[model samples]
Target: MKPPVLLTRDKFRESVFARDNHLCVLCGAPADDAHHIIERRLFQAPQEKGGYFVDNGASVCEPCHLRCEQTVVSCEEVRDACGIKRIVLPEHLYADQPYTKWGDPILANGQRIRGELFFDESVQKVLKQGKVLDLYTDLIRFPRTYHLPWSPGMNDDDKMMQSLAAFEGEEVVITTKWDGRNTTIYPDGRLHARSPDGRPHHSQAMVKSEAARFSFDIPPGWRVCGEDLYAKHSIAYDNLPSFFLGFQIWNERNECLSWDDTLEWFELLEINPVDVIWRGTFDEKTIRALPLPNPEGWEGYVLRLARSFSYGDYPRAVGKYVRADHNKLGVVHNWRTAKVTPNQLAEKS
Candidate 1:
């Protein structure tokens, strides 16, 4: 809510020390200050707690700090062993892809989901063709700027403001706004199902219902996928209309969808998606030691494994979502649809 004073290098070190238990995130060297590898920036904690505190800041050791400098050093190079991975900035995530029709859309012939998915001709074609891969590559090659979509729920409305307040000065990485019905591009490309809430269940049906009404021009090799929200809520949460919300193209390394690729998919699909609450490499201790403004509705932050090194698909990525629900980030709501309590109205009058 309040702006932070830029921390001096010494101040920055102090803050890092305060937050990091005086140990580097990488090596156990007593931290001199916070070392931000992304820009080689450093910040010290204020004598109090009201100074420049970039959300992206992370505590680093001498070795890890040296690797970030543009100047190449041999021994320091090892610190580069596992640099903090950067997320795609919102602008960078959605620059636009070269339009090219790759092939026919893969439909679900027959699918089975025991533990893994089994695809029929409908699904096989998707797997063999790797249409999802092409679409992914194209979107990643260039994505468009993203805008988040809001709903009636308190999840985004309440938690976003908390992250914003606590990490305002920190480096905030914004990714593309994904648009499309919630669709999952199954690695097999055969088995798919839509979630009841419009999230992609699996790469499955294109339910033609009230919530989902679209033309038939599906991008080749891909399915216009997502959940049957209308169906789920309308019928019995098991059948009926579909209220699709998100989309994902089949990736060769479906199990290992990288952060970069995930960004592009969200862009190309044009669906509303969750965002990076806070980031910039740090271990549990350093993160825990750091002091942040406690706020209501705070979900704290999320830590996702680097995209390149990811080992699972969406809904199952090596991502850890954490946050504190307090008075930190205020709830961001669509004031228009927000309710007016009778007590409040009476007070106003």
Candidate 2:
């Protein structure tokens, strides 16, 4: 199946391309190619009651895919660095066989990333290595972001850094951002997750075991990627299903919905999802003027599109404004509170 698209050669790539609006999953890269999901994957259509495998069957390109295989720090080190309390997977995602190779991950920039695609004892052992974790805080400094280890070890700061707009200060309304690695749990009762780089994130064995507990039929036509909040992202530790956050929701066509519609869907699921700030109409300056009311973090905002603006490829589409007072790096942590700024004070008055 040699198609013009980057990952179109593989059927799985076809699935993902059909799913991701042809955009790269990592760094929100526009879809360029197919990334092998080296671990748990199935050649057959997914069924709700049956089990699947770990993400051992998919494929990736280079560099970015490698991040999932291991972090800048080792797994154990990352685990320890983030101070995670537990890891949970019911075990239906994988068959008795192991997955190895994980292959190279596809990047936003057309670069190839590598990961643990092959499921071997060596891979298992490699993944088992120590990760230095810091469970108490999420506000890590730049370069400091990778110091801990695994993606799960990331705290509120890490959470804010990736999902929200830039942080401006204490007035930011920081809510308990949900914790779940970016994933798209399919509505067909299938669970397809991904790493940050647009590579496949399968843990099918866990999906089968964990899925049964939920009352809602995992939506058959939708895939929502958000942090699966467990002990890692919580002040207290727990891996309960109810705790997962449903962030970006995509249709089967890989078309994204408006932020408002997303919120409504979560409501349908009976789950409360956190989001970037929602304010009445304001210009870029006004949005910049408002206090960054987050519990604490900012990757930049996943700005919700108003219904007027919501349409094809709208949820993933965003336009945001930020404060000029940010530090030298333009990093959120470096950004200062606008309360001291003139616009904010004037607005309050």
Best TM-score goes to which candidate? 2
Name the regions of candidate 1 deviating beyond 4 angstroms.
1-111, 114-253, 289-301, 309-317, 322-349
Measured with C-alpha atoms, the lDDT of residue 204 in candidate 1 is 29
Candidate 1 root-mean-square deviation in Å: 19.2
**lDDT by residue for model 1 over 60-151, one digit each (tens)?**
56665544331222112322322423211111111121111111112222111110111224334533443232322211110111111121
Q: Write the per-residue lDDT of candidate 2 for residues 106-220, one digit (tens) a residue.
A: 3344333222222245554544542312111111100111111112233333311222222222122212333234444544444444533333322233433443344245454
| C-alpha lDDT values of all predictions | 0.32, 0.35
TM-score of each: 0.28, 0.34
The weakest ten consecutive residues by lDDT in model 1 span 138-147
The total of clashing pairs for model 2 equals 107
Q: What does the lDDT read for residue 176 in candidate 2? A: 30
